[model samples]
Structures are given as structure tokens and as C-alpha cells.
Target: MMAISVTQHAHLLASRALGWLHTHRERGALPPGCTAELAEPDTVYKPLGETGLAASLVLREAVAGSTELRLARELLDFGWKQLGGGSMLHERLLRYPMMSDPLETYAHYARCGYRHEPLELLLRHTTSLHSTRAAEVLPNRRLAVANAARISGFDRGEDGDEGPRTGSTGGTDWAGLTAATWLGALPEPWLIDWLTAYSMTHTVFHITDWGRLPERLPDDIVRHVGRWLPVWIDIWAEIGEWDLVAELLIVDNCLPEPLGDAAVWERLAGIQHEDGLMPRDGHPVTGDDQERFAAHHHSTVVAAVAGTLAVSRTLGTR
Candidate 1:
């Protein structure tokens, strides 16, 4: 197995990671007593949202076999059901129209043609507001919302500072917002911290439309990411920060010319459990299934995305 091609390794890793997610899909369900009031991003929505994002990316890449594709589609269905077929997002928007998570999460489902007309209607109006455009989120987060708005067909334009703000988004100022993100400035690589590294990765992800358009990243930004990304991945991977490492790898995959580093994928593959669950860090998972799910769910999604995108980059080019 060690001698197998890197592309094969990525596919296997993706298949198993998704298998783990499907087996534990219910672990991602809203807690029995959980209500909208009690639900935080991590508690209910983030897990499924990330899962849907992974599923949607896998489907978009079109590199998976029938079984893997089936799992991805099924996972999308489960995520939508968990969100009440978009009602939960609709209600959340009603409560906090400025909050971007609902619309961002909704975009994952929307990518694959999942729609709740009422939710769409609500999203259309809420996202169009100038207030929503200037919602003061972290810049990368603004990109997330902008990309989501674009997906939902509510974006006025992917504009930037080339044209003045006019104090109205007229849609999203993608270029100006990109300039606002941590990655956009192409900051000194040494300045990044753990959390900011994530902000940077997500900036690239949203700008590239989550690997659909690697060329969307500016040439300088792409060169900066391509140069430093390996070091970042190694830094985290060395400390057993498997989740962060996987995300950084996804950033690599989003490059116009992904490294598709065979050694890295092999090392990552070794981290997967026999059942497909990838641990979040060097620490052993030492809790009940729900505890394990909570601890490692996001990494599992990241691993699935990383592997799927890796395969797409490696094999698609062949």
C-alpha cells in the first residue's frame, strides 16, 4: 500500500474519511434539548455546514468513484435535513440578519441545487442590504459571505476598490474585501499565528470559490501561498495538529499547481483510523462516540476535502 501512487492514496483517504462521517452522521445531529437559543456555531451548525462544504467540494471536483459520490450526496441530504431543509437557516436569518453563518451554510446546499424557496427568498433580501455587506466580520468571513451570496444569485457584482464603494455594496466588493483579508496583503510569512493561519487559509478558500477556480487568487498571493504553505503544513503536522495541517493542504490543493506532495499525503493517510475517523491531533481520542465526534468532526471534514482535492489535482492533471 505504501508504494501505491499518491493519487490512489488520496482517494483511499477520502473514501475512508467519508465512510467515518457517514457512520457517525447522527453524531452531528442537533442535541435533543438543543434549541436555536442554545445553539452556537460549533454546537449545531458548523459541523454539518463543514460537512456539507466537504461533500459539495467532493462532488464539484468529480474525482470520486460512484460509492464515494453516493456518500457525498447522501451527506448533503443529511446536512439539509439537519438544517430542517433550510428552515433553521431561514429562522436564524430572521433573528440575526447580519450574521453570516446561516447564509454561508445555506450556500453549500445551494451549490448542488438544493433549495428551499422560502429560505432563498429570505436570503435574497437579507444579503442585499448594505448593512449585510458591511457587517464588520473578519475580512475572510466577509469573503465567505460574499461567495455565498454569489452562489445564491444575490450578489450585485464581484467589485473592488477600482470602483468607489458608493457606501452600497451593489453586491460584494470582492477585490476590496480580498485586499482586506490577512492573506490578501501577502503579509510576512513569519507573522502568522495559529488562528491567523486559519484566517489566511479560509481567505484563499473563499477567493478560489473553494478550489473551483484556483486562478482567482492573484499571482503574487498564489506565489506567496505556494511558497510558504508547505512550511506551515509541516509546522502543524509536526505537532500533530492534524486538522490544521489538513486545512493547509487544502490551501495547497487550491493552488494552480498543487504540490500533490506524495510524502505528505502518505503521512496523512497513516493518521486515519481503520474505521475512517481522523484524529484531530497527536492526542488519542479517549471519549465516547459523541465526544470523539465533537472533538474530531471538523478535521474529518477537512481530511475529506484535502484528500479529494489532492486526488483531483494529481490525477486530473495526468
Candidate 2:
């Protein structure tokens, strides 16, 4: 069979996602964020938390950039409601600086029974694990190392020292690197570095937790996992490595850009079913037999298709 070019494959994927979105809009099943009421609240107002708001922002910014005038109006109105309502939902939204002003957000979150100290503690514990140091050294820190160690099956050693011994296994070192990268993106970057590192290490090692981690897993960690992992294959491909394509695909569509390489586009084109659904590999890691893995028939497929198309289109523009 002749090889399909990257541009052509991307167009096909974009067409598929656009068609699906159109059908969904027509059926009134489109996300609430895309609705006409996104700006105006009626009796059907649903309060999206910070993460949901962020997702809406990404979608609006990326796919709906042309509809900014409409989205902006809704977003402003939504912001007003969140600020005025004084509800717990709105309060949680305030905890996120990206959602609103930090001081005001924290005040609301505090009023709504949210504690800031715990977040601090979580970060400290995470940092200790990443550094392979004792949490006691940072006496004020709320250590969650025991919890993390439990998840990874590591032992809590004497005198509050837990996890792999010094240079015992390089896995923790890689995990620490991932964690540090993640923590470095936080508001109090140094304090939260540990929590960020812990979450990244956990996600990479515990593949099943890929999409299950809370969105607040340190901004840097989220950004790295969200952005870098998907394009990892592209980095490898640029150096003439095609073998990583399948592994990359497992996490590709999770990001905003799914089409990282010509091979990825080709694989997507081959695997798409006649019913317009992409199958998923039952296992998170499909060892060796990449072709045997199934396309995910869920919303992930729709997002992946759209992202692939968008990346393809952007590449064409360049």
C-alpha cells in the first residue's frame, strides 16, 4: 500500500472530528461550554469547577478561537456568577489563580472550608520523596511520603526515612526529575516541588493512573505530562526513531496535539472504523504489537481526531 502523507491524514482526522462535533451540536449533546448559554445563564446553569473552566478555556482558545466574541461574553458572565454566588463550587474555583484573582480566590475558598495548609504539606512530602531525603529535616512539612511509598510498594525506613535507598533504583531518580519539573511550575515553586514530582513519578510508573490523577497535580507536572509525553514520539522521530510511535499514541490524544508524526497519522487512518469510532487497547500498555491495539471509541477519539487535524493544519500552514 502507498504511504499516506501527513497533511492528508491530518485533514481526514480533522474532518472526522468536525463532523462529529457538528452532529453533536445538532443533537444538543455538545458540551455546555459550547452552548449559546455559555455566556448567559438560565434555569440550566451548571457550575464548572476550576478544572472544567480550564478545559473550557482550552477548547474555546484552540477550536473555537473564531467564536471568541461569543465565548468571551459567556466567560465574563460565568465569572460574574462564580464571584457573586458565594457557593462552595464557586469558592473552589477561587483557589485557582488561573480561574480568578489569587487573593480573592483564596478568601472565597477559605470561606467555603478549604484549607491552604494541607496543600503546603502535600508539596513538602512530595519534595522529600523526590530528593530521597527525610521529611523530618523539613520539620514543618506535612509529609505524605508514607502514602506515596505505599502506592509504589517502597518501605518506610528508620527515622522517618522511606522509599528506595540512595542510588538503589534509578526509577525513583527519573521519578524525581519528573517531579521537580512539575513542581517548578507552582505558585510557591520551591514549596510545591515535591508534590509535583511525586505526582509525575506516580503517573509515569502507574500507567493506569494516566487520566485518573487530579488536575491539580502541580502545574509544572501537569504541563509536562500533558505536553511533552504526547510529542515524545516526534522528538524520537526527528532523530529517525519510529518504534516509539505506538507508545506515544497511547498518550498522544490526551494532549491538545495528537498528530506528532507521519506514522501516527498513518496509523490513525488505518485503525479508524467504518462506524466513525476509534477503538482502544484494553490494556494501557500494548507491548510490541502496536497494530493490534484498538482505537478508543470514547470522547478521547473525538478529541484525538480534532487535535491531530489541528496539528496537521498548523504544520501545513508552516
Best-fitting candidate, measured by lDDT?
1
Q: After superposition, how far is residue 88 of candidate 1 from its true place, in Å?
A: 1.6
Cα RMSD (angstroms) for every candidate in the order listed: 3.3, 16.0
Question: What TM-score quantifies how close candidate 2 is to the native fold?
Answer: 0.31
lDDT of 1 by residue, 31-87 (tens): 776544535677776888889998998888888899989999999999888788888
Identify the runs in model 1 with alpha carbons over 4 angstroms from their true place. Answer: 1-4, 159-171
| Number of colliding residue pairs in each model | 1, 14
Off by over 4 Å in 2: 1-4, 21-178, 181-260, 282-318
Clashes of 2: 14
Candidate 2 lDDT trough over 10 residues, lowest sum: 137-146
lDDT of 2 by residue, 208-239 (tens): 22222233244454565555554454554454
Best by TM-score: 1
